[model samples]
Target: MAEHAHTHTSTPSPVPDLNRNRLPTLFEVLSRRTLPPVDLFSFYIYMRDQQRSVDYLDFWLDVAQHMSLCRHYVRELRRSVLVGTPEPEKDSKRSSAILQGLGEMSHHAGPSMYATEKERDQDAQMSAFLREDRPGAHDSPQSSNGPRNRPSPGISSSRDITSDSNSPAHTVARQDIRASAEKILYTFLLPGAEREITLPGSITQDVTTAIEEFGRDDPEVFDVAKDYVFQAMERDAFPGFLRMKALGNLIPATLIMRLILGLVSMFGGFWAAFILIFLNETRQTRLWLILPFTIGVYSLASYQYSLDPILALLGFSEYTPFNFSRVREPYVRKLLAQRAIMVLAVTILIDAALCVLFILVPGKRL
Candidate 1:
């Protein structure tokens, strides 16, 4: 089952293109590669710094290493068990040697280890049992070499032999696989894990069930959980990662430009409003305040918190940041675009309302 277990997964499991000649990029990994150790580790660090979720990557890396461990244990068990069948003649000789060792320990010669009283009692019991059973069974069953027992008639041909599920080899493999499965279950899937990934109840229950069905009972243990983690990272986390990574790569010159733009928009609008209020001889102008207020609010808030939308606003996303995705993060950018349009419409309506108010009812100087 362990041998067959791998044959199923081997075909679809393409090794991620590491490209050791160049430094690994999260873009390539998130785009075309499976989660490898290095990329995942670096991503884990990035996420950790941002205080984002890293449990998924943690569990993914652990499960991959455990799968390798399962294969290793299975191979070791198979290699060790495939030596040869036991012979009755050799068994009898080994038994006789053990008996001789037990009998002669009391008075061996100059230098010898001593046996305990339990061994003496066991030796006495064995002597009595052998005297009763072998007196008439064979004239000289115990000779100088050893007591001889009849061996098997013949060895079975390779084609005639079949592997038993109850055999020692299978037993050890099951134990190894089950142990591996249990570690995964308790450490990540089960409750009270130090690094537990967020999983639905049904998925958790399925993986728990898989632990009980280790080996041939359930060859695809943790497979569903693995896919879930991978899909989530690929769909949700990677997009945000790509965006953040792009933001992280902004040039000092670009950032200085954004800073200058934000400052000019914010302060320039504020001073313009001050001058308008003064020009009106301290009569507060409502209609003229709308654009300045909008510019000031957006400039102050958008740089840090709303960076992606701001980058798209500055048109950097069309080139550097959005190079990976042909779709251009429509979900996030689209939502932000709607909000921007709404703000624009609201600003215009407010300006019109203030204009009507000023025309119909002029304000006295404050």
Candidate 2:
């Protein structure tokens, strides 16, 4: 026998390069431009605050609209560094810069970081100092040193960004506002309440005022306001279940009544058997057929009554004559035998216990 020649070939597995530069491509940003400016801006701000580069912000923004449409899109974006089709490397930086500029412009109209009362007081003092120092204050539109002034469109006294408050765009913005308001209300206001207390009426008043400030473009503001009112009513109206648990006085009377009725039925079953067995021959034959019918009717009635207590109470009188008859069909006989065994077992157990107790006790009386 010729010795077999053995040959081994080892194929090299591909090693992923960890050092490769993986930045967001320009195509990702351009794709996200299909989303509404507000949603795009919001997503951009989130990415920026997280220290993600402008390229990643663009990629997330492009995928934002698709987020509502497909759940998989979010997972896919998070899994991959570059989502969507990648553009040429040269154009990526320019695309990122444009998106960043748009995001900055959209955020410009929002309240300043120093809009609080303390900040406002400091601003007032600074303005007074500037006025006194400069004597003739040249507050020019081009002056960068003066208070940062937003250009007025002169549309209305409220200085709202949009003219038509009821537009779809405005409704979307109002939703954002309502979400912010809810966060503030729940986080800051609705904590550490001991008992059911009505919400301060001023919270509702403040919400109403906030809605008005947003103007008619967003009816959702009013909807959110109404929701807060309803929530306040709910908090005030319902007592906590934990409070009622301590009382322990309110036993479900209906359940107790059902238990009594069940005990009564057990006694009735024995009486029904005795009456049917001891009756005259003609009546016995008649009752023998009627007993199964009665049992069938009572079982059905009992099943229905189990669901509703009022019906059970009203129909209790009619159920008294129901009796169990000899079931002939094999399937039915098996069911009846099972039920009879259960009843007999319970009865025997109780009787045996009583007999044992009686035997244990010293009795003089015969």
Candidate 3:
């Protein structure tokens, strides 16, 4: 009897049904397959891989170095404007242009130029003092012997025994300060080939005006402006690495949610189908009978979810999986492709539904 049953099973069915069903679409395949864990793994791996790249490290370092340079330049420029010896009137045209540029920069970046509110207040006070109209407010009164009553605190006093000269120590201090100031100006004003060559001429004029206006009251303001500029330049120079860093900062939260969702999605469908089959056991006989149905339902749901409008709105696509597949390593692409079929399948279904709705709705309206 067993042999007869085996022989019967071996015989082909009367109707040729082999080609009756179409292969599952991409969306269907994605939806039926496992999901949550694989999705989480992909997200984690992407972030980890980016962190390990040398470009990420170099980007931040470049920014820090540039910012330092800017701070130094601002400091020097401010000092030169304040106490450094005035350029000869013959060079006034050039000085005027430079000053104009500095002034504009300072004006535009006024808030950043001052280190603190206290510094800004001090500057305001100094400006008020300088602008006072009282005669001899800045100059010391003359004594009966035709000498100034008291040397300005800013000037040096030289007590020379051999010659009746002013204080050499004060003169030396002023000279040293002036020399340091000049070095800073040279570095800040002349960026050489590093800066964009096509900047508007107005930029120079604006920066010069800002420097003159702000530096007149407080030299530190220039330092702040210079630092801000350098930092901005550095950010522009290495955008990729900086972007990676920002992404990295969000990795923990992104990875956790992605991982949990992927895991739940991957196994949840199969379990749900099992429950349904179990509940229907009175009507159906075999324990293993529901496996195919469960798989089909899972696949269908996954495909639908992949094409969800919400995900699409967030710049994600079911066909694209994690959206990093094209940019990622080949091995990662393969892994995601293998693991993400079910999700993709669901997405495609949802998208198809939405597309149909859109078309039908528009036609109905017309």
- Highest lDDT model number: 1
Q: Candidate 1 residues 1-366, lDDT tens each?
A: 344332212212224553343333443343223232223333454444443666666566555444433333333323333333222332354434434343311211000112356534543443332333222322321212111111111322111111111112222333343444455677788877876778999999877754443222122456678777877776777656655433332323344555667678657655655555545543344455556555544443444433434444433332222231222232434444554455445545654554454433443434
Model 3 global lDDT (CA atoms, 0 to 1): 0.30
lDDT of 2 by residue, 210-278 (tens): 433432211222233334433432243212211111111111333345455645554554455444445
TM-score of 3: 0.24
Q: TM-score for every candidate vs. truth?
A: 0.37, 0.19, 0.24
- Candidate 2 at 51: error in angstroms? 48
Two-way lDDT contest, 1 vs 2, winner: 1
Q: Can you write out model 3's per-residue Cα lDDT over 77-150, one digit (the tens) per residue?
A: 33344444333431244443343233311211222234456545444443332223112322322321111122
Summed backbone clashes in each candidate are: 0, 4, 51
The number of clashing residue pairs in model 2 is: 4
Runs with alpha carbons beyond 4 Å of true place in candidate 3: 1-51, 54-68, 71-75, 82-268, 278-366
